[model samples]
Target: MAARGGGGMTASTRLAYQYVVLRCVPRVDREEFLNVGVVVYCQSADYLEVAWEVDRDRLAALDPGLDLDQVCEALTFVEGVCAGDERGGAAGAKPPGQRFGFLKAPRSTVLQPGPVHGGVTTDPARQLDHLLSKLVT
Candidate 1:
């Protein structure tokens, strides 16, 4: 994606992006998890995106009795967080960077955020979609 800048240089403005993998832990005691979703935030471009993969087979392999509906609901909630929807709680009221920080913060729960990673992109939206396809799906 070619982004035009003031100086007529192609792709001169590279946006900064941060992202985290959302994981599901069927059993907290066992310390096991599965990558179920991703949240990507690009502040310079004012872009925030999320993507998720639903693999019942893999989930069941981890825990045959897993309540898939609950797990999916949690994943959806994570998306809501990224979108600043009503489901995001007070975190929704914050700015994009703060919201990203809230989502990327480490927590011990069924739906936990993985490590935070950074990247530079000429087009944040395209990079977001690319990451969703490569990481989530």
Candidate 2:
């Protein structure tokens, strides 16, 4: 049988996903920030994950007094939320969609999420890594 969508690929192979870039705004007042990580969620694939890397030098350039440890801690909390483990606490207990919503919600904190963007991917994990490299790194 011919595959659907004339692409010779089953729907299962092309899963829709959404992602957001996580930024660290050392000083909310100045609104200066650096891309530190990315969060990817695919409901069809039941996948949710986050990857992050901190450029200590770049972050320090934004705010000399900014605490690097605090930034790492916040990023860890986000990773925990994506994992839906105990580290996320109450937010982690919710389903993937809810967790994504909570994470994408706007906040004034140092670590904030950018606008949500969507795309199709065959492998959510691979897509997450690609986004992490393209957008965060």
Candidate 3:
């Protein structure tokens, strides 16, 4: 459901939204992690977006020996997965929902998606920005 807001803006419909945090673990054995990015998807709106912030200072705090290059590459991959672009490879050919599912799947890697969280939103794009701001950055 939606309502008209002030300024003649129509409130967005209550649509389902899913999101996950991207974590980077320098050493998986010790299990310490840093939230580097976020992925958001709204099936109803056919929207999938990825937003990330990789602060070298924070990464170094996690592991002084951490490879900044590798981390950036991993972040790029996440963005590609969300974009479903040619860079995404085979996964890019899939639909928006499938791309989201692939990104959210559990995997042991430098860049891993945390648990998926659900919520309601009027605008998926706006919601993506909101979640990325609150959760990732």
Candidate 4:
């Protein structure tokens, strides 16, 4: 028999999630970028979050003139959106799925998101950390 839990639901079942790698594009014209973070959205779990780390040495190598502060500020805004906080502006007020959609949309900016990818996991938070380590670090 299948295991059950609260509300008669499966106690430990895999959940579908979507994610994108956040990139620091120092030069939009040249399209050179470094993977800097990961954003994961799991509707089944009502989860949306981002994990990022700015590799100062790598970023400086990519573009010595790049503005690290501005990139970090942009990433903060993204975090706010994921948290549905005021700092994210209008996007943050949106629903979790909508916020994820906003984050995944393509844009020409210092911080850009890579293509969306999907996976299955029982825990999105752990998955985010895993992707951040594997893809960004």
The prediction achieving the highest TM-score against the true structure is: 4
RMSD of each: 4.8, 6.7, 5.5, 5.9
lDDT of 2 at 76: 86
Tell me the tens digit of each residue's lDDT in model 4 across 27-121.
99888999998999988888888889999899999899999999989999998898888989999999999999999999999999999999998
**Runs with alpha carbons beyond 4 Å of true place in candidate 3:** 1-10
Clashing pairs in 4: none
* lDDT of candidate 2 over 1-137, digit per residue (tens): 10112123354698889999999999999989999999888887777888899999999999999999999988888877888888889999999899999999999999999999999988777788899899988
Q: List the residue pairs that clash in candidate 1.
A: none
Poorest 10 consecutive residues by lDDT, candidate 4: 1-10
Whole-model lDDT per candidate: 0.75, 0.86, 0.79, 0.87
Query: Candidate 1: where is the Cα deviation over 4 Å?
Result: 1-12
Question: Per-residue alpha-carbon lDDT of model 1 for 1-92, expressed as tens digits?
Answer: 11212223247687677888888888889988888877778776676666777788888898899898888887777666667778777887
Prediction-by-prediction clash tally: 0, 0, 0, 0
Residue 31 lDDT in candidate 1: 84
Models 1 onward score TM values of 0.82, 0.90, 0.88, 0.91
Q: lDDT (0-100) at residue 98 of candidate 4?
A: 98
Expressed as tens digits, the lDDT of each residue in 1-45 for candidate 3 is 012112222475677889999899888988989888888787776
lDDT head-to-head 1 vs 3, winner: 3
lDDT score, residue 137, model 1? 68
Better structure of 1 and 3 per TM-score? 3
